[model samples]
Target: MNYRKATEKDLTAIVKMMADDVLGKKKEKFQSPLPIEYVKAFQNINEDKNQELIVLENEKLEVIGTLQISYIQYISYLGGMRAQIENVFIRADQRGLGIGKKVFKWAINRAKEKNAHLVQLTSNKERPRSIKFYENLGFKATHEGMKLHF
Candidate 1:
């Protein structure tokens, strides 16, 4: 297995992984399948220095996991920055193989590389295993995650 930052060419596979994540849990905010155009948007994230999408691939170069991290500059903390993790997913068959953890570790390092003051993520209550996994990786559940659906 290997890991690398995603390129535009990898969008289709990444979108599939994202879909898997949405389907694997109940109470997730995802409401429908992602269109290929949605992945195209992520592909353009490279234009922003603070945005990144990464993928984990098997020996055959097939993407099996993905994660996106965004960094935002903040004035409240004296110009410090925060890194937010979104859309973390590992292929269903790839679970329990440590691929997810490796992806997260890479994300954390990438955040630090960007000089972020903190790295954060939120998981739904229905995903207890995901919450535990984040906690095991030194992420603290310090805030309530609230969302207003349209």
Candidate 2:
């Protein structure tokens, strides 16, 4: 698998992968031709210097995995930057092939290159498997993550 920063053209494929999962299937809209908002959101993320939306591709250049990393500078980390990983997804058909590990490793390295002191992410409470996956990657479950959805 190969990884690179995502282009506008990769947005649809990325969204499709996001929607392929159990939780996402329920939340993501999959209209006949999809929606333009996905592209618009990609544009906004792309323009943000703090955000890096990336994709993993096969040798044929078919996008198979994607994630977004946002670098944030905050006083809480001693005025250092932290990387927040989000929207992580790999093709369901492509799971267990070590693709997710590769993608994560790349993200961590990228964060280090950006001078981030730490990398963080939040997984939904419903995904025990994913939580374990993250734990195996050496992430601590020290903090209780909470969110209020509008």
Best by lDDT: 2
Residue 111 Cα positional deviation in candidate 2, in Å, after optimal superposition? 0.5
List pairs with backbone clashes in candidate 2: none
lDDT tens readout by residue for model 2, 7-86: 98787788889889999999898664669888789889999999999999999889999999999988885799999999
How do the predictions measure up, each by TM-score? 0.84, 0.95
Give all candidate RMSDs, comma-separated. Answer: 3.3, 1.1
Best by TM-score: 2
Error of 1 at 90 (Å): 0.9
Predicted candidate 1 versus true structure: per-residue lDDT over 17-62, tens digit per residue: 6656655444332334555556557657877778887788899888
Off-target runs (Cα >4 Å) in candidate 2 are none
